[model samples]
Target: MQRFPSAISLFAALSFGMPALAEVTADDVWTNMQAQTRAMGATLTAKQSRTGETVTVEAQTIAWTLPEGIGSLTLTAPGFAMVEQGDGTVQILYQATQTYRMDLVIEGDTATLDVRMDGATPHMTASGDPGDITYSVHVAGGMTAAVSTHAPGEAPVTIDVVVEGGEAEIQYRVTEGPLLAIAGQATSLPGRFDAEMQMGAEVAGTVFGTVGGAESSFELNLPSDGFDILNVAAALRAGLSLDLKSALESSDYTVNLDFYGQPFSEERRWSGANHAHFSLDENRLFYDASGVDAGIVMKGENEFDSPVDIAFEAAAASALLDIPVSGRDDPQPFALRFSFDGLRMGPGLWSLFDPAKAIPRDPASIDLDLSGMVRNRVDLLNFRQFVGDVSGLPEPELISLALSRFAMTGAGTATEATGAFTFDNTDIETFDGLPRPEGAATYEISGVEGLIDTLLSMGAIAQEDALGARLGLGMVTDSVGEDQYRGAVEINEQGHAIVNGQRMR
Candidate 1:
C-alpha cells in the first residue's frame, strides 16, 4: 500500500522537470521523463500520442531490480496526459481512477499487489526552467486506495485506505556539478485504513486504524555519476545525500486475531505528536525518533491460568543513533541514546504477581546515553561477509567510551551511574584477549533493601538468598544516608579491578 504512493510520487517528480516555456514542448517533457528514469537504473516504457496541445502516455510500465539480486519490482500505470497551457506552464491531468499493478519477487517466493487510486478534483501544474522548476500538486476532494495482495500458498490480504485531503510542492534544480537537487514538502489530512486477512479455518485477523494527520518533507542531492537506484552503495560513494523528516499528529488502531478457536484482541491510541528524522551521506548515517502520550490495551488468555486484561498509560520513547559507514585510518565518533518513560501497568497485571500490593507500583523507565570513538578495520557497508566468521577479519577497535548518564527505575527501586573510559588495544592479553579498559565509575542506589524484603515476604526469593544479597551489598557499597547507597568501581592502569579502594586482581 505504501509503495503505491511512493512510486507515484517518484514518477511525478521525474516526469515534470522541464525547461523554460519558450523552449519547452510536450515532447521535451516526455523525453526528459524517460531520460531521468533511465538515469536512475529503471526502465520506463509507454506509448506516446500527441493531438493538438496535449501529449498522452499510456500503458506505462516501470521495472527496477533490487540490489544483490535479492528482489525485483515492476509497476504498471494506466496513463496520464501532459497539456501545454501556452502560458509558460504545463497542466498534468490524471484520470478519475488510476490502477497500478506491482509484482515483486524475493528469493524463491513471489507476491503481487494491485492498487486502485481514486482521486477527486486533483490538480497538478509545473513551471520554470530546466535549471529550476516548481511543481504544485493538490487533491481538494481527497483520495482513496484499494489494495489487494496475493502470494503463493497464502490467503490474499485486502486493504482500503482513505485520505480526506492533501497537497504537495516540489522544487527541482540542476546544480553546477551536474547534481540533481530536489526538495519537497507535503501535508495530508486525516486518514483511515481497514484490512482483513484469513488463512486456513483456524487463522484469521482484522485491522482497523485511523491517522489524525501528517506532514513530511525531504531533501535529496544526487550526483549524475553512478546514480543508480539498484546500486545504493555506489550511489552513496558518488556523493548522494538524503534527509527526511516527518511528524504525525495522532493515531488509533485495533486488531483482532483468532487462532485455533482461541481469540485475542488489542487496541492502541496515541495523542500529541510523534517525530522522526533520517539522514544518510557518504561518511555516516543518522536517525532519531520520538513519540509521546501513547498507550495499549490487550485482552487474551495467559498460561498462568488467568484471564489477561492488561493496559499501559502515557507510554513514550526516544532513540537516536549516529555511526560511520566507511573505514578510515583515524577513529570515527559514534553515539547512541535510547530512553522510555511513563510506563504504568494496569492493576490486573500487577495483581498476578503481587496480590498483596507489597511493591510500589511506580512507573518504570530506563535511559542510556553513550558516545565513543572506534577505528574500523573493515567497511561497514560490506559487513555481511564477516557476519558468521568472527575470526576471519579484525574487529573495529574501541578507542574511548563516555557514559554521560545511565538510569533505571522500577519496583520501588532506582539506580544511576556515570563513567568514562579509554581502551588499551595494544594490551589485549591483560584482559584475556579483550581490550583493557581503564576508568572509574560512580553509582548511587536507593530502596533496594525494601524491595528485597518485599520479594522475600512474597516467597519470590529464599531467606538464604536474601542474606547473601545483603552481604554482597555490604562488601561493595557504603550507606551514604537512610535508604541510600553510594559506591565506586575502578579499573586502574595496572589492570586491577578495585571496588572502594580494595583491589580484586
Candidate 2:
C-alpha cells in the first residue's frame, strides 16, 4: 500500500504545467515534464509535432530503474495532445479508450501489465507556473489493468483490477530551500479485482472481490536538492514528511481453491466503514487503521468424510503505532495500541469443540495499549549498511515502558493488567548484562475456577490436573470474590522479584 503513493509521485513527474505570468505554451509543459522525469533518475522519450495551438506527442516511453539493481519498470503509451487555451492554462486530451503496456522485472522474474483506460468524458487541465502548478483529472469510465507474472519453477499468476468513476486534483509546488511540496485528493466510485493461479496439474485457485467506494488524500514535502526516486533512505535522512488518509465504504471477496481433486472455498464480507492513516517525518512515523463489522465463512472437506464449515464475525477492529525513526541522544517517545471487539463464532464452529454447549457463547474481545521511551544510537537511514550488517549497530537503550491497559474477555471469563516500568541502563551488570527494570504490575481474573470445574466435569481435564491447577492458583493469587482472584508482582530496587509482598529472588 505504501508503494502506491511512491508510484503516484513518480507519475506526477510527467504531469504538465507552467507559470501564470504568461500564456503557457505546449512546449513549456513538455520541457517541464522532461526535466522533472530526469530528476527522478528516469528516461523519457517522445516525438512532438506542433500545429496552431495544439502540440501532439507520440511514441512516449518512460523507463525507471529500481534501487539496488533489483528490478525495473517501463511504461509506453501511444499518443496524447496538449492544447494551449490562450488564457494561461493548458488542456490535456486523451483518446476515449487509451491502452498502455508496462513491463516489470524483479529479481530474476518478469511481469507484464496491460492497462486499458476508458472514459466517456475524460480530461485534464493544468494551470499556474513551473514553481506552482495545479492539475485536475476526471475519468468517467475509469480504468482497468491486467497483470501477468512469470517466475522460474513456479506457476504463472494473473491479476485483473478495475476502478470506476475516478477523479483527482493535485497541487505541486517548489518551495524554498530545496524542497518540493505536493498535495492531492482522489476518489473512486467502485472497484473490482480478480486473480487466478494454476500449478502443474492438481493445484489451482481464484480470488474475486469488489469494493463499494474509496476516497484518499495526501500531502508530501520532499527534499528536492538531492532527490533520487530510487534512494528513499536519502529522502528520509534529508527530512521527508508525508501524510496519507483513505477510507472505504465496504468490501467483500470470495476465494475458491482446488488441490488434488479436492475443493475448498471461503467468503468474506465487511460492512460499515474502514479507514486508515499513515504519516512519516524525519523524527517519527505513525500509522492507524480500523474496520467495522467484518465476517468470514469457510467450507471444505477432510479425511473424516464429513464436510467442514466454520464462520466468525467481528464487530470492530483497530490498531495504532507510533515510533521514532532517527537516532537521538535523548530518549524518544513511542506508542502501540491494538483491539478487537465483539468477536463471535457461529454455532457450527463452537459445536465442534463444545457439543454439549458447556461453554458460554459470548462475544470475545482483546485489547492492548503500550507506550515506551528509548534512546537510539544508530543511523537507521543508512539502508544498505543496516540491511547488510546489523551486528555493528548499537543496541538502543530502553528508558521506560508503560502498559496502560491489557485485557481479554470471552467464554464467561475476563483478565486484565496494567503496569509501568523504568529501566536502569547504567546498571546492566546487576541484571546479567541487561538493564534492570523497576516497576510493579497488578492483575485481576474472573471465572477461572468455574471454567476449570466445568472442563473437569466434561472430562476435558483430569481430576489430578484440575487439582494441581487450583493449588498453583492459590499459591500465586488471593481469592477476592466468588470465582475471582487478584494478584500483584513487583521488581524491587534491590532487583528482587516480589509476588504479593513476598520476595522470590
Candidate 3:
C-alpha cells in the first residue's frame, strides 16, 4: 500500500450515467458491500494468493477516505479494517508501516462501477444488473476488459475480451490516450489461418468522442490464398508475405496500402510489402491491384492473359475516394471476399458518409487491371439493369448466370451515380434494368440537415441539400433495419444513373 493522493483521483473517474447519488459513509463502503452481495446469493470470497508479479501498492491497512481526500487513518483492527456499505458499494483503504493501500472504491448511485486490479489504475466496473459489468483493464501499457455478465450467481463469467493499445483496441476505446497513436495491423486469410496485428494510432480529438484522428505506420502478415477462388488456384504456392505498413493522416488525406507479400507468386516467395502514409483530414483513397495477374475466363479461353509474372506495382495512379471512416473501424484490419447476387454496393459506400452530403463535388477515382476472360454474358453492368449491350461483339449463348470476359486497364471515376464501381471483373457490378423513360429523372434527398458537416467539406455534396435528403432515403425504401437499404435508380444506354443512391441527383 502507498500513501493516498491528496486529490483522491482514484486512478480514474467512472459512472453508469444513472441520476442517483445514494450516500454511504467511508466505513460502510468497506464491509457493507460484501453483506449486500451475499444477500444477492453471490458466492463471493477473498483469499491471499501469491501472484508471480508485484503490485504497485505498498499494501497498507483497509479503510476509506472522505471526499476532501483525508485518507489518514490509524486503524487498531487486525490485518485491515474499514467501513462496510449497503447497496453493495464499499470503500476499503489500508495502512502499512510507512505506506497506504486502497483495496476498493464503490459508488452506490452512478450505476458505473470500477475496481482496481493490483495495478495503479482501475481494472473493472459494474453497472445495471448482475447480467453485465464494464471493465477498463490494462494489459502491458493498454487497457482492455470484457462485457462481464454476472448471470445472478454464475461464477462471474466474462462476455467479451477487448485488448487495446500495443495489442488490440476494442471499438472507439483506446488502451492509451490520444497522445499515443495506435499503430498495429491485423490480417485474416483462408486455410484455417488467422492473425492479429498491432498498429500505432494517435487520436487528436477531444474526450467527448468526436471524429478526426491520426495513425502511425502499422505492419502485419498472415497466411492465406487471397480474395477470390480465382486467386486461390494460382496463389496456393507461397514465395512472399503480405505486409500493411506506412499509414498516417496528413493535411491532404489518409493513406495506407495492403501490399505485404512475396515479390513473386511462385513456390519461392519474396517480401510483398505495401506501405504508405497520407495527410490528415483527407477522406480519399486509391488502390493499386496491377500486380495481380489472374482474371476470369472470356469466350472459353483465358483472356486475362497478361502473363502471370507476378512482379506488379500495377497502376499509374490510385483513386482518391472521399469517404468518411469511423475511428473504431480504421484499425480493425479486416477483409472479406464474399459476393452476393444483385448486391447493390453503391448505397453501402454512400452510407459510409454523413447524409448531409448528397452529391460529392470531389470526384472519387479508381485504377485497376481487368484484362481477363469470361465465356458467358456481359462483364459488368451499371446498377439499374441486366447485362445488356453486346450486339456489336460476338454473341455467346445465354446459359447460366456465368460471367462474360473483357480486358480492362485504366482509371474511371464514380459518376455522380448510385452504383458500385468495379475495376476488376465486371461480374461484380449490378444492373437491374435501365430506368423507365419517364417515371423519374433524378430523386433529390432532403431533411438530412446537419448530419454531414464533415462530408460537406469533403466535396461529397452540398450541406444544405444533404440535410434535406438524409433520412428520407430510408423512409422511401421497402424495409427498415440494419440491412434495409434502397434507392430509386434511373438508367441509360451508357449506364445506370442513380438517384437516392448517389449522384444522388
Against the unseen true structure, what C-alpha lDDT does each candidate score?
0.73, 0.72, 0.25
- Expressed as tens digits, the lDDT of each residue in 18-68 for candidate 2 is 223444567766765555455455677888899999999886788888887
**Candidate 3, TM-score vs. the true structure?**
0.19
User: How accurate locally is residue 459 in candidate 1, as Cα lDDT from 0 to 100?
Assistant: 99
Pick the TM-score winner.
Answer: 1
Per-residue lDDT of candidate 1, residues 125-177 (tens digit): 66666434455665554567787889988877676666553333333332223
Is candidate 1 or 2 superior in TM-score?
A: 1
RMSD of each: 3.7, 4.2, 25.4
Best by lDDT: 1
Q: Residue 407 CA error for candidate 2 (Å)?
A: 1.9
TM-score to true structure, per model: 0.88, 0.85, 0.19
User: What's model 3's overall lDDT?
Assistant: 0.25
- Winner on TM-score between 2 and 3 is 2
lDDT, candidate 2, equals 0.72
Order of quality (lDDT) = 1, 2, 3
